[model samples]
Target: MILNQSVIVDIKDIIDKAKDKAIRLVDHQRTIMYWHIGKRIFEEEQEGKDRADYGNYLTKFIAEQLEPEYGSGFSKRQVELIRQFYRTFPIANTVYSQLSWSQYKLLIRLDNQDKRDFYVAETIKNNWTVRQLERQIHSNLWERLLMSNERESVLAIARNEKHMSDAKEIIKDPIYLEFLGLHREASYYEKDMEQAIITHLHDFLLELGNGFAFIARQKRLHIEGDEFFIDLVFYNRLLRCFVIVEIKTTKLTHQDIGQLQMYVNYYDRYEKKDFENPTIGILLCAEKNNAVVKISLPENNKTIIASEYKLYLPTEQQLIAEMKKEIEKHDYEMELPTS
Candidate 1:
């Protein structure tokens, strides 16, 4: 009699689970190892009582002794990093296993304690990987916080006690669109730019920072018997609000602001749930007349933002020049005696 054969073991599932468990175990061990290394280095440096020279010599000696045995991972730079890691985070208990060594390296480089703490909390809260953390840091998330709100207010939000209350709280001015790979001086139609953004949606969202999820592209709406299509729509889970993005290939006009405002109003009144906050409208234009934008909006306007989009990232010199011009303008205005 011929017996029918069937497989009893699910090898693929078993292997997958084993791989996941192994990864977790490795990460846990690495975390504990780093913490111990940091602690030991810190103690040795302290005992020497000459921190600067001691730190330098310690790293060199450790590198020389460990490199031959352990491989390139024990280089002088890495030893220095371990020393810094200890110095930056003195409490070993606070070391997070979920955070990779690369993430810690980034955090320890930040000189400001509050900024480091904010990043750490946000990374943990959002479950951000090292790449996401790196991107957020490169995008100047700390500078954005400073520009978005008062120091105390931002600190409160950073501490997770409060949510961003307005569009200005979350929107970055001069939204970087360099990933679209368009030339700054080259003229392009609005539709062309919109299509590029659609094609590179993932990169665009990464540049847009965290908590944003794309809702629709070219979303249609009807009002007063006229149909209008929004360029892009996003929902920010953290802020609990709809974000309407409008693209302009030319300099911004008052009409553009008005159009975006209409979109924001529509989303706030119709699309948003009762529990959700007011919708935010962002006008991403090639250029903006800040004076016109200031005058076009209401005195208490907080829902609409007119931000210039740059096809290329600004050079250091360009940013410095712009900052100097702003300072000069402010100083000039201050010097002009009040009527």
Candidate 2:
């Protein structure tokens, strides 16, 4: 993927497109082979209606004959799995090329269509590897997201149908930083954590959710005679805005919120173009006081968000405890009387 000189960029683009198409062609052919095998098995079953309801027996018989010639992949169970694959994804064109057979195997096993579609769409949209997809499924990503948001939001994200309107739509709180391999107990400087995140930037971006494109790190800001650096800068394609992030390995304070707000204002006025939306500032911290966050921002504030990040994934009980705390906060907010 070497970049050619500006004048010859088209050659590189052409080759890349060709390579992508070749891969797609191979994927399509392999998918077609499986579908054809499933179709043959199904058609054979249809003709055996007059025979004893020995479809399983016949399957074994077929496997016996084919296993010798076609190898172990033709085992009765593998044949059934192939048949199930075709049954699950009946339409050939609807089968996505972005997913490999391994991914499809995972998809086909899920009996629920909505759940299956969610994973399929997310895998394609996120460019998730088979292992990543497996992890997401195991983590119950859909269920966890649904805990915080409306079902529509979960569905929209899974279907790639959601249009992000604000920072909250695209930004995730308590983002997993396990990919950094940092120990939560270890005391490390902010630079060490930031550098680790930068090193695993791609995974961090995926955990951040969709549409975030990294711009710069420690982006310098000059205001009056003072110079300050924001921890991270990214442009969100979906929100059409610059997002400035500040990292704190301590619980967030009111002063921290104010600092991030200042950074957001700086980017909005100095860096953002007139066509771009207002810049968003996210304070990623070890912990945050949600009440402090609510009071620090103006009513109807959309630009500044305080989110917690975790170095290690919490256990299911721990996650439940956290969600319960959030729900309690929301309940408290609803209980407050309006002026």
Per-residue lDDT tens digits of candidate 1, residues 74-138?
A: 89998888878888988877688767777898999997988898888878777777887887776
Overall local distance difference test of candidate 2: 0.83
TM-scores of all candidate predictions against the true structure: 0.85, 0.80
lDDT of 1 at 246: 94
Taking the tens digit of each residue's C-alpha lDDT, what string does model 2 give over 1-339?
Answer: 886587578878999999988977887788778888887777888888678866777778888989999898888888788888877887878777798888888888786777787788889888898888886776556555655677677678668677767667657776778889999888998899899999999888877877889999998888999999999999888889998889999989999998999998888778899889999998989988887899999989989988888877678788788788878988998999999
TM-score of 1: 0.85
Instruction: Please give the range of 10 consecutive residues that has the lowest summed lDDT in model 2.
Output: 138-147
Q: Where does the lowest 10-residue lDDT sum fall in candidate 1?
A: 2-11
The lDDT of model 1 is 0.81
Question: Top model by TM-score, which number?
Answer: 1
